[model samples]
Target: MSVPALEARGLVKQFGALLATDDVSFTIQAGARQALIGPNGAGKTTLINLLTGVVEPTEGQVLLQDHNVTALSSSQRVRLGLSRTFQINQLFPHLTPAESLGLAISERNGSGADFWRVAGTRPAIVAEIEELLTRFGLEGEMDQPTRKLPYGKQRLLEIALALATRPRVLLLDEPAAGVPEEERQDILAALSALPADVAILLIEHDMDLVFTFATRISVLVAGRLLTEGEPEEIAADERVRAVYLGEDAG
Candidate 1:
């Protein structure tokens, strides 16, 4: 059997008496399209934290391509081909989209300290930044500071930044959140166009995006894995309907 791109095994996290994640475990194969959905306070954020090494799990392990990475810091994990976006935008407000991508790519190449001074000197870096911005549909806005761009564009730039690291597994934490309805299609398009070799684990609440993008879905309830199945199975599940639509599970 082939190893998964990402795995969380028997994970648990506790902050004092509050158990944030309880024995949660799952895997995403290379190029898999998966979504993690749950009601509010279902421990989704905490689980992402554990997976990305933002917080340590009290118990259990995180494995990337079958290597134990539970002890790695977040940056180490990023270097090991694991990267993530955020629920809210995480971008440099004053940096243009081109500058940001250049910096991220330069950092990944270990030359960020002097990237700004000699950004135009590197043909490879310039070509990559152009490719990424063009891929994300930000070519027109490349020269504007991130804060000057629309919320949706800012979000797209953040995703592009995460991709700059060339991760094998990408965790998207609410990529569509706060995006206006009209701009959402752009986000969806960029996501659908991601490199097929990269496994994406989307954590989102937009049913439209979730159901449309994910082939497999995992539902969480109160910090535990409620169930995981194909989109059809998840949609037809009574417990899932109850959690989302306020129907009675009993």
Candidate 2:
């Protein structure tokens, strides 16, 4: 079998007396469209942090393409083809989308200080930036300062910026959060069209988005791997229905 794009092995995260993640284990195969869903404060954030190396795990390991990355910092992981977008937009308000993409792409090439210079020296990079902007529906917003764009556009920019890193695995945390109803479909379309080679793990609360985008689903409840399966299986699970689907368990 091909190696998984990302894997978690018996992960556990504890804070004082609270067990945030409890012995969870799972894998995201290359080219997979996976969703991680759960209730509020269900340790989803903690698990994402552990996977991305934002926090050290109290126990267990994270492997990227079967290589141990449990000891690496988040930035180090990003350098190794791991990238993530936030639940809230993380963007530079002053930079245009094109400039932001240039900066991220330049940073990927170790030219973090010279985004414009990189674009000047490399037409290929400029083309790439333009293409990504178009793909994420930000082409029209490209030249405008990020802060001036609508919230949905800002969310798209954040995802575009993550893609700018050329990641093999992408973690998306609530990509549609705070987006207006009218713009939500655009976000859904953009997400549905992501590069197939880049495995994605979506951490989201939007059931419509989750069911629409995921081929596989992993349910996290109180920091544990309650279950993982195809979307249909997950939707039909009695336990999942009880805890998540708002259906009567009986």
Candidate 3:
């Protein structure tokens, strides 16, 4: 059998007496578009933290391409093809999109310390930055400082930075949270253009984008895996509607 792109097995997290994640287990098949959805305080963020090595699990393991990465640090995991974006934007406020993405690509290449030489002297890296900016619809804003860009564009640029790492499994935490409706299509389009082999585990509350983008959906409730199925099955599930998605979710 082929190994999954990412997996969480019997994961648990606790803070004093609060159980943030409870025995959460799931798999993201290679190249799958999977959505994780639940009401607020459902432990979605905790789970993502555990998966990305931002926090250690009280119990269980995180696997990347069949290798155990439970003990790895976030940077080590990124080197192993695991990368994620945050609920809030994590971009260099002072840097332009091109400069930021160049830094990311350079870091992943283990040559970030040599930026002065690499940024201008490396044709390949320059080409890659241009490609990423164009791919994420940031070509027009490439020279503007990230703080100067609109919220939607900043969100897109953050995702672009994640992509610059060339991850095999990408965990996106609310990529559309603060983006306005008019600009959401830009985010969606960029996401749709991701390479087919890059598995995306999306944590989002926007039902429209969720339903339209994910082939499969996993519903969490109070830090536990409530149910998982195809988008249609999840949409029709009464339990899901009552606990999370509204009755009119479909």
Candidate 4:
């Protein structure tokens, strides 16, 4: 059997007396689309941080493809094929989307500091960057500065940048948070179309998109994993319905 694409075993993180993540444990199989859902302040982002090495866990381990990664730094984790996008947009405000993606791809290829070398001068790299932007539906706006793009477009660009790293596992923290209702579908579509080789661990509040995209769902509450299973099973679970799904009838 193949090892899971990502695993968090007995993970724990605390800020003073606050237990941000309490003994969290879960595994995301290769090629799986998994949703990590919880109400606000449920430690979902903290867990993402732990997995990506943004905030070191107070205790427990994070494994990427069965390799211990708990001790790795964020950049080291990215180099190891683990990548993520933030809840807030992170982009080069003045650079065009094309330029931003090109830089990202170049960095992933270890040529980031070659400022003297123009990305457009490299046909292969330029072509690849254009393809990524087009794939994520940002082709027509490629030449526009990131700050000029709509909020939804900026979010999409962030995902595209993470993809440029060619990650084995993608961690998305609230991909749809600030997106308008009309544009949310585009975000969902792009996320659903990620390559099968890439396992996704998504932290999202949009239940419609979450239910539609997640093959497996994990529920967290009070910094602990409450339950996890297939969407239907989760929906039918009495405990889940009573606590998390009370607003929607089972």
In lDDT terms, which candidate is top?
A: 1
Query: Candidate order by lDDT, highest to lowest?
Result: 1, 3, 2, 4
Please give each candidate's TM-score.
0.95, 0.95, 0.96, 0.96
The TM-score that candidate 2 achieves is 0.95
Error of 4 at 210 (Å): 0.7
Global lDDT of model 4: 0.91
Candidate 2, residues 1-250, lDDT tens digits: the string is 9999999999999999999999999999998999999988889888988999999999999999999999999999999999999997889999899999988888798877763553636887888898998899888988998999989899999899999999999999999999999999989989988998999999998898999999999999988889999999998898898898873233
Model 1 clash number: 0
Give each model's whole-structure lDDT: 0.92, 0.91, 0.92, 0.91
**Residue range with the least summed lDDT across 10 consecutive positions in model 2:** 112-121
Ranking by TM-score: 3, 4, 1, 2
Q: State residue 16's C-alpha deviation in candidate 1, in Å.
A: 1.2
Which candidate ranks first by TM-score, i.e. highest? 3
| Tens digit per residue, CA lDDT, model 1, 1-250 | 7999999999999999999899998999999999999999999999999999999999999999999999999999998999999998989999899998988788788787773576757899999999998899899999998899989889898799999989999999999999999999999998999999999999998888999999999999999999999999998988889886353233
- By summed lDDT, the worst window of 10 consecutive residues in model 3 runs over 112-121
Task: Give stretches of model 2 more than 4 Å off.
Answer: 113-120, 247-250
Q: Whole-model lDDT, candidate 3?
A: 0.92
For model 3, residues 107-139, the per-residue Cα lDDT tens digits are: 898887883574746888899998988888889
